[model samples]
Target: MSEPGLPPFESIIAGLTARPLARCVVVAPHSVEAIAAVAQVVAEGAVLDLTGDRARIKNLLAEAEVDVSAVRIHDSGDSDTAVDRAVDLIRTGDAEFVVKGSIPTADLLGGLLRQRLPGRSACASHIYVMQLEQFGGRTVLLTDAGVNIEPDLATKAAIVENALQLYSVLSSARPRLAVLSAIEKVSTRIPATLDAAELRLMAERGKLGAVDVDGPMPLDAALFPESAVNKNLAGEVAGQADILLAPDLNSGNLLAKALVGHHAPAMGVVLGAGVPVALPSRGDTVATRRHSFYLASHLTRSAATSPNGCDRE
Candidate 1:
């Protein structure tokens, strides 16, 4: 869902580009796209820490003609070692944020979660930011696509909290959240609906802060005004949802992939961890990965200045 006067998603991406690039560690950058993406970031003046095969990294950077003056390498022969080293960099404040590269996402995230970081334990979840043409180029946020498989109510609550933290970083306005399900009515038979209703109640009780929460909503009713009108569903978030909390990882991942498959302007990040993590899929283009880095860096900057910061852990 959209607001009339808010800046477009493209503007946000452009703003991120205009800002000085933050220190980032690219973990296991062993793929073509990862190299290309990091190369572009380095060329654009980002100080980067790379953990991977030294020879392969140098060859690729030379091909891209990226200035190695600003790049630091921690040669690791194994992907797991690379991932662990990246986490250590963040844990030691050597890097502001992390960027996923060639390694399996599970390996990178497992390292981040299981390792003893600076902060206390927190539930980590992935959040996707996308500009969908179908929504009139509106930017939407979707959560748990990269983490949280089949979250229970407590985990869902944690995801919502993480999304709200991200929304605050992205906008000054209060975010409208929609807990999406297959239908728009509360029904005991559908577990998602039950969860949605409870979430809405939690919002009403100020448990989720000063945000507007609506749910047990179908996709159409959540974002499209016409659908909400036809369905007689009216709420602050019914047709203007800024954040979407999916029922589970299966649905969340599929919906997020659908948007990416359409080549929508996009970025993904993992929050609620001790540190912010940029998420780049195996097949993501250089542009996508670059934007993800910018987004994660932006989050890092925002958190650094704020007293609460973004780390839920």
Candidate 2:
């Protein structure tokens, strides 16, 4: 029998409606996309605490006739200070999570990393949660695609740990991790394969948290049951991985786009910071923004279920 993990993305979105959340979002509203994304968040019933260009945001919302009853505006002046203002909200207990509005991802994340937030990890990694039909509607994760560029072995381990923490919150079963590589053989010719080998050993030694790790595997083996069977691979995570740990950013980014190219059924968030962070792309649709915020808010709803005790009210 398959292990119990997160429900399908459809069910997750439905659950948000079934169990409404009470959360506050601190956003840097500068671009048109930011306002559009924040509209979806407010539609989800979250209180929006706008942190940039207070007057401009108010005027835009008024012109668009967006319901501002639940919106709160704060004057931060510019994107740089807006990030600071958002951090201040997190520090003062005014907001629970940070949403990437119009702020550049590098600036926002860099600013956040400088803060000494509670429960912060050495490395902050991004996890993309997707429901793959090839995996029987199972919710799977692809990690560090949007954050780390060229993570070393130690950084890859931190990324895996972050993914594991998030997995624990969303599932009842122990996470089955597949460390992705070019091939299944551990050869020094390929550095990713070596990292995969180390990660597997670390998991066996209880160094990578409560999860089953298998790696040095190709993508075909990671997501295809037939490939696992044909190759005679009998490990626990051969074709039933809950999280697919990418070797580096280039491969991770390409893999995610390939898997989710035709549709938009993925939810993304950053872990390892003091709180869950949603950094949805500016080009993403409003629905994507809604689901991303919902994903972050869902993590915040229960402290017992949050990764590394990372969620804060």
Candidate 3:
């Protein structure tokens, strides 16, 4: 039976089974939740962890039926050294992904992005959270609330790219993106509205990939067909939006929370790196955490099986 008010984690896991797990280097392996997750994945493929509690880890491995040799458990006698070693693995290509364990987020991210990590061209990375909701009969992309602060136009563009890439990978379709604002019209007084107009043009000129872009939409017009029609917005994407590009973190975060607060199912992943990264929060329930792992795992596997982020168009 499915869990009450939450989507079955298996639904996401079943989708992920098509792809192999992304190799990860977990910092502070002493974390119970991290160890359990790693143990489950290690049965199929190995992951590296910086943990000195070898005996506990060993027991978890045995119970999970994972090969003892499949995982490389590193002992970081001190907290300072653990971060150093974890970062080293990413720099040396020993691990493709990093999972934050007992360590704080700031510490984990700081180490992962240490001056030496490759593919770092100031690409302006952000997290795109996709919730599988039956919202007016479609799935939509919501983002940046889980990452980024007050992003400017350039950073917003990059966030769009990240979301588009994931949509292309998962939905196998060119997402119709609505760059959201408080109102449908561009206004110089509102910075977000002005940026929305710019993004729309970027999409039209084919600079933002193969996607239909419309913008400066109010929240109602972006999500509901009647609202778009009532406002006389003339565009296929107006009502059938596949992605909603939030102006910034505050709006995006609030929207995501509202969805979950009303019992919507969500799965989020961090993108634009060499590999898929899972950044589930501690406050997130186990179901949310597992779903995120499914997203990262599936995306990694899909990328491996087919290049170009899974969109042939």
Candidate 4:
């Protein structure tokens, strides 16, 4: 049976299997784990283009029993060139998304940003879909944990907008966004609270689309009904937020790490770009990476079909 309040894992896998192959480009595909990730997705009908050292990639493919005929191999010789080639494919609409391999995140993102795909947002951000057992199988969306150091009000607005887009694709219900801050009250000393107030107003004014956004709420009040009552917080988003908009990268990163460290199942993707970027950490398990692939594929398909392009459900 499917978990309450969350889609079943088997259903997600089945959805992925039903879709047509998503064209993917892997940059710096040199490590054994990277090769295995690519192979796993390829078996699911994703057409892959592995760019990196020619001899090394070919040798790894041979060892993994990945058929050379099934994938396109691009010999870029180095990480920099490999990233460039992958970005070029994205620019030309030949690839739906790019997967990070053995290359540094800076290198891969740098190349992608330089190309500046047409549909790219002003700022790119990361969002993690986390399923914590402690949360009673609820999936929480957390943002800007992997990117954006310390965003200002305007940047935070964009981050929320980007996350809302992804949330719309994943869930059928209207998203309730809790803009997280240290406290629930807007104070002059706390810039995050001020920003949260502005964001809430923006959503109320219909500037941020269809999400029910509330802000200046603490984490506990945002996720726990009892805490919300104890704090005397009264809002639709309190204790029922589908998304958590973090105050900054440090807070967001720490929250996500704490959940994962406690063995919560999580997957993440990069948004605000022309294509969804599957960005699993280097230390992530193969299962995590594969799930990220499925997430990206679903986002890609959903975005393509949306008339307003990820901005509407």
Candidate 5:
């Protein structure tokens, strides 16, 4: 049976209505597409333009009926510089978050890591995109597909941690994790299965925290209780995962792409930084971009307010 009480994306936003406004400093505010999206977010009380462009910048300020002089226009040469400035603003509490605009993902993250923004959580930090899978009234989070290439066991653990941190903000309890692989049993040759075993042991030993971690499960068994029962899988997380951790980037990318290709409603973001970063692709629909911005804002507002940065919750 499908889970009950699974809320839609809009309902999640509505639930957060009582939270304070989310303030963000965008890296590039001039790209017509980006600016338009930012404008909509600003209108919704979520972002502030921080790009150094004067002409388009002035127009946005004017459109908002805010004084141009009140905003600072830094003559940063590249998106990296703008990202650096934005991260600084976030760290100093001048802004609550940062957004990637007209910049390569590398540049944004390069500046962020080099600048030691938000107290530098860990060098092994990773990114995760959450897909809300509605089944039997339940929402399942499938992640690490939009970010992270091929990751080793340690990196996989970190990626799972990063995703779970976001789940904590979105839900009331800890999440159940399914480490995906081609089969349900470990073998000597398949590295994913071996890693899955280790990850499950890590969870059992409390190294992976309160999250329930199970792995080496086929995708079918990961999402459908009937499949789990058919396979005689004996665990709560086997077919009822709150978070689906992909084995590698190729799998993750393909899975997310397949969902979108099939017309599944989804939103994505880069997590594990000091704050949530909206890194939507240029090819995404305006609605997807806007929804990503909303997800990022939700993550930023609920992110822990400590300098240590890494979140175990």
Candidate 6:
């Protein structure tokens, strides 16, 4: 049976067949985990272009029972070069998105940044979209968990904008954003609280576009109405945030892992790029990887059709 807050795995795979399959470039695709992820996505009808050691990747794919004829392979000789080649495919429009394989996150991101791909945001951030069954089908967005380590105020704003853009694509309604902090009130000792306050002001001044932003809100208050009331917080976003902007990567990463560890349904994507980036952790299960690909595929199609398209140069 499907989890209450999440769609069934088979349903997500079936849904992909109705749309044009995204051409994905996988960097350093030789490890068992990476090969498994690729094969799973291939089964769902995505076109995969792999970059890595050709012989090794082929062997691994064969071992995984994936039909070699279906995938396009690019032999880049080494991990660094494989990542570079994958970025080039995205740059040349040969692929719709890039997925990390056996390569390190830093190396993959380095190749992409060096290419200076058009439509890339000033600061690319990571967003984890989580579905909590306990929340009665609520989808929550967490930002900068896997990318930005300690973003400054300007970078934080950019992160929020990137997340908001992606959320706008995934959701029909304007999303309510909660800038997370340790407490519900601003304190000079806590820099994040101050940053959150300023971010809220930015939203109010029409600087952050059409979104309801609240800040310095604790996690409980952000998600639970009773907690917000107990804290004497009264606002549309106080207990109804669709997005939770983490103070930094540490907090965001911890929060995301904790939820995932407890078996909550989640998927992550890197925003602020020419194409959507599916970045499932190495430790993530095959189910999570497949879901990430499904989300990235949908986002790719949505970005292409959006009025303010994501592929703008």
Highest lDDT: which candidate? 1
Q: Give a tens-digit lDDT track for model 4, residues 1-313.
A: 1223335444555565567657888888788888888888777666788889989999999999986777898889878899888877887788888788888766776667666666777567789888766665567789978878788877787888778778777666778889998999999999989999999999999988898889799988888878888888887788777789998889998988887784467888887666788888876777888888878877776442111222111
Order the candidates by lDDT, highest first. Answer: 1, 4, 6, 2, 5, 3
Clash count (model 3, backbone only)? 0
lDDT of 3 by residue, 1-313 (tens): 1112212334435666557656566667565566666666665464555444466666666666666666777767555566677667766767666665566655555544443354432332445454445454345667676656677777677777777667765555457788888889888999989888898898889987888889889867877778889878877677667778887777887877776565465656766545566766655655565556657665554331111221000
- Taking all chains together, the TM-score of candidate 4 against the true structure is 0.89
User: How far in Å is the alpha carbon of 303 misplaced in model 6?
Assistant: 5.4
Off by over 4 Å in 6: 1-18, 134-137, 302-313
Better of 2 and 5 by TM-score: 2
lDDT of 5 by residue, 1-313 (tens): 4342225555665664445447767776656666666656555555364765666666766665544433465546566667767866776787766667787776676666555555333322334343444444356666676555667777677777667767777776657788888899898888889989999999999997779898889887887788889878877786677788888778887776765664356666676566777777666766667776767777775553222222221
Clashing pairs in 1: none
CA lDDT scores, all candidates in order: 0.80, 0.76, 0.63, 0.78, 0.66, 0.78
Evaluate residue 80 in candidate 3 and report its C-alpha lDDT on the 0 to 100 scale. Answer: 54
| TM-scores of all predicted structures | 0.92, 0.90, 0.78, 0.89, 0.83, 0.90
User: What number of clashing residue pairs does each candidate have, in the order they appear?
Assistant: 0, 0, 0, 0, 3, 0
Q: Is candidate 2 or 5 superior in lDDT?
A: 2
The superposed Cα distance between candidate 1 and the true structure at residue 249, in angstroms, equals 1.0
Off by more than 4 A, model 5: 1-7, 17-20, 55-75, 123-138, 301-313
Model 2, stretches more than 4 Å misplaced? 1-4, 134-136, 301-313
Q: Candidate 3: misplaced stretches above 4 Å?
A: 1-13, 29-31, 42-70, 77-81, 132-134, 300-313
Error of 2 at 235 (Å): 0.9
Q: Where is model 1 poorest over a 10-residue stretch in terms of lDDT?
A: 304-313
Which is better, 3 or 5, measured by TM-score? 5
